[model samples]
Target: MSGGADLPGAAHLVLADGVAHLDLETAVFNAMLEGWARQQATRFLSSDGTIQPRISLVRRFASFTNEYPWQWDSADVEEFINHLRARRPSFAVSTGRGYQNILRLFCEYVTDARYGWPRKCYEHFGEAPVQILHEWNTVTHSSDYEGSPGRRPLTYDEVQGLFDAADGRVEEIRKRRRKGALAAMRDSILLKSVYAYGLRRREAAGLDVADLRRNARMPDYGRFGALFVRYGKSSKGGPPKRRTVLTVPEFDWIVDALDQYVDEVRPLFQPGKHPALWITERRGRISLRRVDEAFETARKVAGIPEELDLHCLRHSYVTHLLEFDYPERFVQDQVGHEYASTTAIYSGVSDEYRNRLLHRSLKGRHSALWGHCFD
Candidate 1:
């Protein structure tokens, strides 16, 4: 293989069947993958995420067809998608559609004349790769909300129980003289902060000491005034978005919790000069997986429903803010949603709150009718 340095399996498989000539098919396939990777890297301007999963999808499709991209057609794609649908834990509609979309991009890239893959394939193998995915065969984005029905906002009682269980974990560990007491304390505060600020897991994990700022209006809360989120979700390969969330009166207890953690418990980790708000035992920033695991462990101990996950804390935040009669646009901005409709999807107000709203509407109507009758 002439370009064997970078390709995963290009070392010993260059000459085909003891032939004197280099294998054109193997060389072209590896080149196509390399070109696609470079294109993505240049487009995104950073390689933090989003390339590896796509490459894995290409490899899986190749394994399924046992043929290179040039040999694929619509029928092969249809059979491969059907096989995925028939698996025991079949892929969700959104998952199936994502797989198809990535494959479509690969085909588009390989068949484009500018990349030279089509010309090289034609010159060597007498054929070129063509797009196999069409609109009729792929999943459509039918609704704004496509999440599972089982997942919903946790009720106020459930949120309290979850927090209690997390705090209890710290005490339980400390009583036994165990080693993970500091880590548990960090997880407990981290979970509370997530709900307090209506934050995504990544946003919570990306926090630094400087990200916490003081609110002039709420000077009594001191340094735990607001959070400036630097890594809000992006769209269309854009840079991470940014938002600032102020501390509300309802979640003011978090001020004390955060102040204690920053002053006392965090020092135990010996994270000298590290800026991350949540420090792991290794003296580095905690990963997103640990944030999720901490939530799941607390939920199970509190006997909460299994469907509730870390995102549910954010959902609960939106729903409770709505219950407290906060404006819809305010809630949307707090959670960094680009659209109010996206924020609405996270809101699932309790029946009691709905009834109160209904009563208020009736009372206003009744008062207007009485005035009209008297006049």
Candidate 2:
């Protein structure tokens, strides 16, 4: 074909040419995956995290079906989904939907006539691949928030206990002359910063010293007045979203904590010229796994429920901000949520806050009847 190399997915190229008899099917399947990877890369999907998992999922689906793309049908898709549901500790609804979406995307790529996969399959196997995942068969996104029910905002007391536990770890390490005191201190500040700024794990880990910015209005806080988050979650096939999370007055304690870490504690690690806000013992950037481990350790020490993860700190931030009487739009912007509805989902305001709100409403509307009661 003309301009074969110029095709979106390199669909004009033959992949299974000169393959051994027993390896032909495998070679063709591998080629299809490679082509898909190329296409996704062209669209700016991350190879390390996004494209690899997609290719792996396609391989898994193929393995389950025990058939090539041309032989895959609606029954295969349904059966595979049923198998997923039947497994011990079955996948979450959102996870199942995500799997189906990936499979559907792969099917769309292979069945498109312009991609030449369909024509190639027909020539090789006497049948073209058809899209197996359909609207009726696939999982529907029925819920706005499909995350784990166990993952809710921590109560105010719980947030305090968690932070105290993290601080205690630092103290314990220092008392025992443990090697990880610096790391413990970093972990303590990291967890606090996560909640203080309503940061996702990656966003916090991806932070550099330069990300700390000054707010013109909040000069007292100096460079800690705002966080320039460059690693906000990305949309499909897009760069990471960026936002500036302004330091709110309620969480202004973070300013001093961050200042001490940046000025005094971090220098002990000898992270010479490393721009990372959080550094490891080896003077490298702290990893995401380390962040999780830190939170898990503190959670256990604090006797918090096992279900509450690092992300719960983020939920707590949203909830606590709402409780502190911040506007919903302000909370939404702080957390980098695209919609106020998403901010609402993260918020689990305390019963005390709700009761106070109710009392205020009643006192405002029926001062004669409710004013004395509130007092």
Q: lDDT values of the candidates?
A: 0.85, 0.90
Per-residue lDDT of candidate 2, residues 1-375 (tens digit) = 322345667555646345466676777788889888988989898888799999999999999999988899999988888898888463788888999999999999888777788777777889988988888998888889998788899888898999999999999999999798989999999999999999999999999999999999999999999999999999878999999999999999999999999999999999999999999999999999999999999999999999899999999999999999999998899899998898999999888999999988988889886577767
User: Model 1 over residues 1-375: C-alpha lDDT tens digits?
Assistant: 223333332222222233434666666677677677776766673455677788788989989999999999998888998898888353677788889999998887777665666666776789988998899877889987767677899888899999999999999998999988888889999999999999999999999999999999999999889999998887756898999999999999999999999999899999999999899999999999999999998999999989778999999999999999999999999999998889999999989999989877777778677755433
Candidate 2 clashing pairs, residues 3+ apart or interchain? none
In model 1, the runs with Cα more than 4 Å from the true position are 1-22, 88-90, 370-375
| Structure candidate 1, residue pairs in collision | none
lDDT value for model 2: 0.90
TM-score for each of the candidates: 0.90, 0.94
Candidate 1 all-Cα RMSD:
5.0
User: What is the Å distance of residue 362 in model 1 from its true position?
Assistant: 1.5
Q: In model 2, which regions exceed 4 Å deviation?
A: 1-6, 14-22, 368-374
